[model samples]
Target: MNPQFEELQKRMNHIGNLNNYLEDLLAKIPGNLLSGKQQAKLMDVLLDDSDLTSLLEGLKDPRPPRFVLVGRTGVGKSSLINAMSGRYLAEVSDVEIGTEEARRFTYESDGQVYFEVIDTRDIGESEAFTKDADAEAELAAVVKAFRPDAILFLQKATERAHSDIDVESAKKMMLSAGYGLPMVGIITHVDELNPSRIKDPADYPPGKLALMEDKKGQLRRIFKEQKVPVDAIIPVSSYIEWSQDPDDLSEVERGELTIGFDGRYGIEELLDFLEQSIDIRAAIHLGMTIRIHKISERIALRFIKVFSTLAATVALSPIIATDIAVLLSLQTVLLMIIAYLSGRDLAFKTARELLVSLGGIGATGFTLRMIAQQGSKFANLILPGAGSAISASIASGGTYAIGKAAVAYYLKGVPEEELNKVVKNARDEFDRGLE
Candidate 1:
């Protein structure tokens, strides 16, 4: 395991998982929009203890975003993964195993894994394998072995050899994935397009852009003609020439979007597409992706958003202390997760102590939220439509305040004196936006 995320797991070990309180709070919260079925679905997610442990294990080992690569041999599969990883995770090998196992290729650096993919065996390459191997049944077995979060059909930006065979094979694989699965068409090696001198994608000339658009259009047209479902068509150049020494990288190169080679483009966009198209629970693992230390901050930022939104949306119109307790419990869990993400001890005591440090003007937000709730109650006597909106506004703002304050403290390490200002500013800013 990478020293960074391995350390994260060590820190997480200190925290206890008490999902019961969260489940109870969620069950009690009045859902204005959620039906009984949705509530039950949410509870079922929390009830499974093993899933929670597996999530943390995924971060530590870095095995998630299980993608199924659907294409013939070559098309820069190794380079695509390596480019996405910003490391030499996959070695391009010339020798073929002559096997059709659909093996899982795991990419790990410094012992921490980032992701895994089902590298499917090339079909129709050998007439003997295609005619006699029962490729369809093999693919079904693959589906059981490695359930993919996304499926990608790959083609070289410069070559079109066996495109028909690749597309047909992709259609057959869809049976294994089941219908409605997100399938993306990838046009790789865009740097090899016309005007090969244009290496950096940032400086892609008009000729290169036209060629890329042309390829994307062709891919899209083919998929449509075949009646094969594809969610997105992306043309990407996944080649990145990194320095042998990672620490020797420049400031610009160190940035997430910037790569060592100029021709690298469309990868970040593809990753964004995967995050959006993948399962919501799977997407959560994305927080720990890329830079290990900063992964925590990303996770913490998302936590604040998720907890605040859940608290606000589920809050009852009456906005009683029960509503506050719901918010508090969710916020507390949010803090615990945030703390764990920051590589600190993940415990209720840690959150409680930090919260105590924030001072209790009803824990810096509750009292103000209650005051607003009381006013909204009176407003309900007159115009309930306006009062309901006001209640939502206040609940959202209050929880957001607590969350932001904790983020500043835990993630940004903002000083104690500054936390109150953050709380007040966040609450005021959110409330104003709602207004």
Candidate 2:
């Protein structure tokens, strides 16, 4: 066999092993920690019999994940899309006559299609469009042709009002797309609500938070009243957190102030909702398409916590060898999961190789010595005649360091030589406990 083909076969076998390991590990995690549905989806990509090449090709699949934006003009549909995609892919217009036709906006990165958005004209621009038989038929025909996977019914939070025509238009779009399709109710322009503006979203003032929640509640009530079968109603602001100069007067002059970096709010939550609400394959496709580094980092950190906890628990083993064995296994599995979450096409063997390069289980004796030398600092936590607490501390800290190293290597694409330095620095910090 060709050497390249032989290497491919080896990689495939390694991936198979990794998949089986993940299935077993996820099975062991309590259902409360990870819902059965989420576990199943995580395992779905692995459980399939498809080859690595085919799975990757599927990522670049031409059938982009389609989303239909349903709302009247000035509801911030274009702004919302631009925010979610982290780029100026949509044409944002201030005029009330937004997107007269079914405009398809495709988001791609590195020359690969990730997802598509069908931006339709304002559903109910006037009484003539809403009540006229011909206009309604034309709108329905356009939506039917696009066949979106989901629909975003956008309403402005500052408007504080929902006309019957607005509700009816939303219902009409849902019906035209065929019932049971996932529809998410989005209240855009949320920053314009009371409190007027906020700089740090993470530290929202109590009044601001309350007002945001109130707006969400109001939208939900309207959706319920309108009989719109929406999966979720979330409030978002496209300009709350700008990625570029928030006060860039040039962009303001162009009437594109809302289109920038770091201006996104609740967009991550919106993405999370879509991931859980849509098909697993579609979710993966979207993740690849959008390439949202923040969301990827968030997922990586979450898995880090999960594995860090497991490592701490495993460290409680009475026998040193048993503790070392379990910690190594747990760390190995943790790295694999992180690699996957980071969207890296890494094989199990490659992950293990990377772990070994970071001193892995082979250097556990050295790790033990390092822990012992630093054990005095944690003596207060370690009970007399019991070393388990110290072991737990070392395991947790080391596992955390290992997780961070893996994220830097796989996700951040840090060079191997530089990454080795990062790992060494991390281990030293863990040994010293930030002292």
Candidate 3:
């Protein structure tokens, strides 16, 4: 018991150190600290460094096809990576404990075409084992380390999209980290269909197999609702003994793809997509991905403002009644100082990453005001005078905690509501373009 407790403590300490380092590193970045033209100059340099042109030059295989297999735990993400590599590059199993960190496997055919596949473990794990924010950070690290050419979102076709959990989980991770990178879906485990199967619609459930045109429409409709656009959805089976008659009229192709010296699912289309569609050498996707990260960064920055504002209101309680106008000015001045102090440890690179979105500043300011007002309301509920500092501090702390949680919740939840909004906006803009 003591050993277990000690191990848990060690893990907590490690995470704490990592978080502290990130905060400190992000503080020194001039793009996050400076304002006006100075910030612009620093941003230009930072973006140039992070952009496609700079990173692509360093790639060992300039135009090598690289793909990251991203999906929920137990969804066979590692298996897909290993299958594609034609070797045991990534550990595979029915159980979900193998991948706890990012696994990178590089394959080269001849000297020209190189394929690097990255596997991340933060997707689709239980709440007890993973947090949404931690998963986002881990994926961001994966993106920063190896910006893949394309993403293969592997989902088990045999498994129904029973709940919104899987789609929502992937949405937050990708949008928060990978952003605008192109993605294709491989609905695996389709080989599980019975050998004698023909045209019994009841054999395959509605959502499981998008066999017919209407089924494809249904699948696309939901995928659209989830804000996940797939370039293609290829159904597959990775079963060991799975086989199909080559001459059969089954819409699902067989013997076209093989895995582990045996026939398996979705291998052909997956390979063809990578070979034909993905431009493994381009940098344009990196710039677009940065924009997606900016949306989350802006939301994070807003929560930070709320925290600092509440802190100031608590610290300056005594002078509030003396002059409301003067106190408000003092609060503003303090907020600026707090922003600097909090951001002091940020790195030049990390800050630029956080400030890519133009909307972050205004959103942060608005969120801070909301937090401050909530804190004031709570303070009014407390009896004025005597132990005011103690009461106000508690109120302020509660408000800050709730405010941050709310922002996190919105980032996870609002995208579902905003999916239709995004599609509508795209169509409206397209019509304007046609005009």
Candidate 4:
């Protein structure tokens, strides 16, 4: 790692540790609120909410997507994985076997694996006899053991050799998965198919576009003939522009290969197709992994809802002071999570400063509505059940306000001074929402 990046990572860890310490202190000031039963309640609420159901399911499944890449040698699968990851990972491998694990590309973030490209051994070069069994048979056996999220059928538009075997292998893998698996036909090396001079797929002239269409048609017909189901066939150029580490701007400035493949094209379209076509679980994983612009806001909203619900249930405890303390702690954590999900590398101190200014964790104190909300806590002794309902409502509203304000700050670029107004507005809305 570069020194600068390593330093940034260290700072981030330190801030996270501080926030964790703060949360721990808050949890203890009033008492232990996160009992086993309360934790179960949070989980139940998260699972019950439809928006967060799939996200929670995906987060727990540590195993990344197994994308079975089926194609002959030189089909550009290795380059495609690098393009997707935006780095030099390695060559493709037969993902079934444990050998050559380093060569397999897995999309990871902060040490958590998000997605993996299980590139099958280059198959159908002419008919290959490999160790243990034929290429297709081995792939079938692997799929039988662990089903892939989807299959990527790769072929070069300019040179598609032994296309029949590509279709056959996908067929066998689909059968092995028991349930039919969605397959995407990828036409690689599209930059070479054109008038050659123009490399960007978006800028491809009618000639190149028509040629890609013909290739798609050919692959589609082959898969259809073999009775294999295919979701979409896309044309892409997987050539990475930089041969050197991109961080070294000087090296990249001198050694960059700026051409048709300078900026990879059609990858976004392919990912969008996968996110829209795959099962809910895989789609959530892909959306989170790539941070797809199309669905990122939805994912963020899911987390917001999760934290808000957690705040509500955790506030249901009979002790009013405990409920309030827990809500404050939960709201702080909610802000941290919202900032993170918004893809912002925020300094915890910056957030703390903003919260203090808004009277979130400072002597500036609560707004009128908040004072009333807090005043309702006294009802817990007199009203009991009704007081609990009011407490839960207050906690939920406060959490939602903090969550929306954090989203505005991190995602919408709302100015810090203006965030208080956003929080005020959200709180007002929640107040109005109460019957």
- The top-ranked prediction according to TM-score is 1
Q: How close is each model in CA RMSD to the real structure?
A: 8.0, 12.1, 19.1, 8.6
The candidates, ranked best first by TM-score, are 1, 4, 2, 3
| Candidate 3: segments with Cα more than 4 A from true spot | 1-64, 82-114, 128-135, 161-163, 177-179, 195-218, 240-262, 282-435
lDDT (C-alpha, whole model) for all candidates: 0.65, 0.62, 0.43, 0.63
Per-model TM-score on C-alpha atoms: 0.69, 0.54, 0.38, 0.56
In model 2, residue pairs whose N, Cα or C atoms come closer than 3 Å (at least 3 residues apart or on different chains), thus clashing, are 114-289, 241-262, 241-263, 242-261, 242-262, 242-263, 243-261, 243-262, 244-261
Task: Report the lDDT tens digits of candidate 1 across residue range 373-430.
Answer: 6467666667655665666666666667777887888788899789878878887887
What lDDT score goes with residue 387 in model 3?
39
Q: Which ten residues in a row have the lowest lDDT in candidate 4?
A: 251-260
Tens digit of per-residue lDDT, candidate 4, span 269-312? 88777766666566655554454443445545656777777777
Clashes of each: 4, 9, 18, 1
Assess candidate 2 and give its TM-score to the true structure: 0.54
TM-score: the better of candidates 1 and 2? 1
Error of 2 at 87 (Å): 2.1
